[model samples]
Target chain A: MMSLRSFRDPVLVALSLVALWQVLHHIAGDSAITAPAPTLTHLWEMIGQARFLPHLRETGLAFLQALAIACGGGILIGVVLGGHRLTGEVAEPILVGLYSVPKITLYPVILLLFGLGMPAKVAFGALHGIIPVVLFTMNAVRNVNRTYLRTGRTMRLAPMQTAWFILIPATLPEIFTGLRIGFSLTLLGTMLGELFASQRGLGFLLMTAIELNDVKTILAIAVLISAFAVLCNAALLAVDTRLHRGAAPETSGK
Target chain B: MKKATWIRTVFLVGALGALEVACRSGAIPATMVTAPSAMVTTLVKTMQSDEIGGHIEQTLSAVAIAMALSITGGFAIGFILNWFPVLRRAFAPFLAAYYAIPHFAFYPLLIVIFGLGSTPLIVLATLFAMVAMIVATMTGLDRVPRVLLKTARIHRLSLLDEIWRVRLPAAAPHLLSGLKLAVAYSFIGVIAGEFILSTSGIGHEIAFAYDNFDNPRMYALILFVLAIVTAFNMTVYAYERRLMRRRGI
Candidate 1:
């Protein structure tokens, strides 16, 4: 499926999209609708004025705090539950069922418990994120090839040594996969909390701009947020690829 | 396996019982945690009333429409990408990046463009659902073995015949998975949209109840949603399992 492709097609597609956008802007003049140029200019202005930083910092801090807890706790709990066959079997169905329920539905409960503040946002984000991390890590731990352990045992490796070298290496790829998914969910959960009831953050800014009908600023924020998502995902993907270097080819196509 | 099921059931029941006790004993504040019995009563009352029904209908319709559009649109987009490797290559990075961002963040712009109504909700849901569909469709179509195509050619099958008989079956499983994902995301997107801007729908009900501090109604609504989602998940899971069994997987 990975075919040799010309370098020009994306550039062509992007340019055509911009051209179409400009055409629409011309056709729909004088309304509050955001044109590409104005949105970009507003984005630049916001950045220059450093108005985006505080909100970005707030969002980032909450996300980081949640991610830290989710990664540490999720991995630990997942390993324990998944390492034992009996517990893994009992937990799998329950976890999957819980995961199916939209995590956002629990936002109200989080807000109620933690109130309309950073703690609520952080808890919400952590709750949303921990599921995928736990699920993936559990699966990775459970599905570690028996042959690897057998090999370790034959080599006279201690249980801990075997776990460190064999089990950990075997699960790293899936762990990375979970981390990536968990990170995205963490971002989503934090944003949802902010959108739901926060006094400040990117989501708050988006809501404010919406209320004011500031289409340009709204669009600008949208673009910036999308760019941020893209950038973070790219960075994570780079790290994931490095960690999974030898395994890339096998996992790539599907 | 039987022991596991028993254990799981007992655990669930025990947790519910604990919550009920906690709520009743005032260990947890009533405003924060509605008692289990109260939640049940509220659910029953809402079912008797048409108010909850209307919200359910609104939410379901939006989700249904969004799911349909995303499936069709995503299929087309995926096909186009499959047909053009260059475009796919160029767009791969952008596409991968989308997964990191919450699609709900774009709802404001959607509202600006589509105006305040189901239009924005449906559009947002479709966008959220369609990404997974597109990816699934691409991968599914890619899985159409060369041998099948060769056989179709050897049999002198028409394009439509080849697609219906050979390609569709080959891609069915992945497409089905995409459909499941689309369904889940559509529900999420529609609900989130309603919560943010809509004046109606179950999401609106939940938000309204939350704002009004109608703890029973809010808890009941959440339970209702959880029930609906869990039922949907079970159905999908059963269907997937059946398909797998049929394929001897």
Candidate 2:
């Protein structure tokens, strides 16, 4: 059974958030924002609409493709750089610099190259999500216990076997953390991509709502996206914590 | 210079040279991307024309205000939260989930509430940037050595003095990193908001140029933004390294 103490904080946070929303709604008036209750009702209505499915499908497809590229490309780059010390050192600063740059500025360039479509959206999403995964995986690989490598060598394992059997398992926990962070960033990037110069998707809907001064639709969409993001992040965070905890004792024992 | 730095410099230069070659040779169409040299010349010419000065000033000032607000306000809020375990516990999940929420989604809502001007942008940017500082402050405070607190207590220092003398110095590194992130996020929030919808700013100009098929001007503006941000970050990073070195960390 879940403990009361553990449940209490989230409830309190949720109530306070609702309270803040209500206050803001009152202050901003009906034209600027709908009350929380009305917004929730509007969101339900939105979910049931025939047109909503296509936009949902578009966003979901783009997000999944972006996630695939981000995870795969990030892990591959991470493995390559991490396995080679000099390369990792050379690339580290460059990666960090790229991470901080407001990549939104590059959207025009991306559009010019990829054109206005799924490719552009997926590319933008992957670009945001890839860096943290690389950074985390690189560190995890670098920190792999020397004894494990020695054991692999002693067993006369091939390089590929060593990587698969030894390296991946050892770094999985930290790498999972990277993936969790990457998941959120990729979603953010994809949504940002759709926000500008897109004809369909939730972001496009949001833009349309903004132009039409449709406060209810805007809030409903924002709430919907934020809910999805938070719920997914919470799940990933739970798995991430468990993995890290599971790894701790093994390292200490070693 | 160090070997890695040397190699990195060469690598960067080579990449730029390759891009220049491609652009000049029609391998990459001018419609797609302007040459690196052409981007530089256009940027220089744009600066000389001074037409974009107002846009630059608008973006930079908004970023500056957002950074200032987030840094100071975040530190204060973080300090209070750290002092209250109950509050911290309640807020922890929200804090953890904060960045995932696609904050730009609220830009239109903010515009509606605050009306069309820099207010909404500043508020949005501040909200976006402040959490980094708050998280950093909490972490920095949490990691301050127990022995330092003991020393402070033994000296009979007041709470304010204890925090100022012992806590702040000990937490300076994390705070500095937080400062770096705040600056970056502020720029991101402001530029992205302006890019999405704004009457005047560098981001708006870039979007305007993009729509008009002014590839040269668009690339030049992009180049300018990237250069300034990179330079600013490098300065902060250098300062952080110097501080770390002095502290023998």
Best by TM-score: 2
Model 1: runs farther than 4 Å from truth?
A1-24, A27-32, A50-52, A241-245, A248-254, B141-167
- Candidate 1 chain B — worst ten consecutive residues by lDDT sum? B92-101
What total of clashing residue pairs does each candidate reach?
0, 0
Highest DockQ scorer: 2
lDDT, residue B209, model 2: 96
Q: Over the stretch B1-249, how does candidate 1's per-residue lDDT look in tens digits? A: 488888888888999999999999999989899999999999999989976788898898998999899999998898788778767877765666665566665676566568777898999999888988888888899989899999999999999899899998888888887777777778888998888777999999999999999989999998998888888878888888898899899
DockQ of 2: 0.71
What DockQ results for candidate 1?
Answer: 0.53
lDDT of 1 by residue, A210-239 (tens): 777677877787778777876787678767
- What C-alpha lDDT, on a 0 to 100 scale, does residue A61 get in candidate 2? 96
Q: What tier of docking accuracy does candidate 2 attain?
A: medium
Interface RMSD for all numbered candidates: 2.6, 1.3
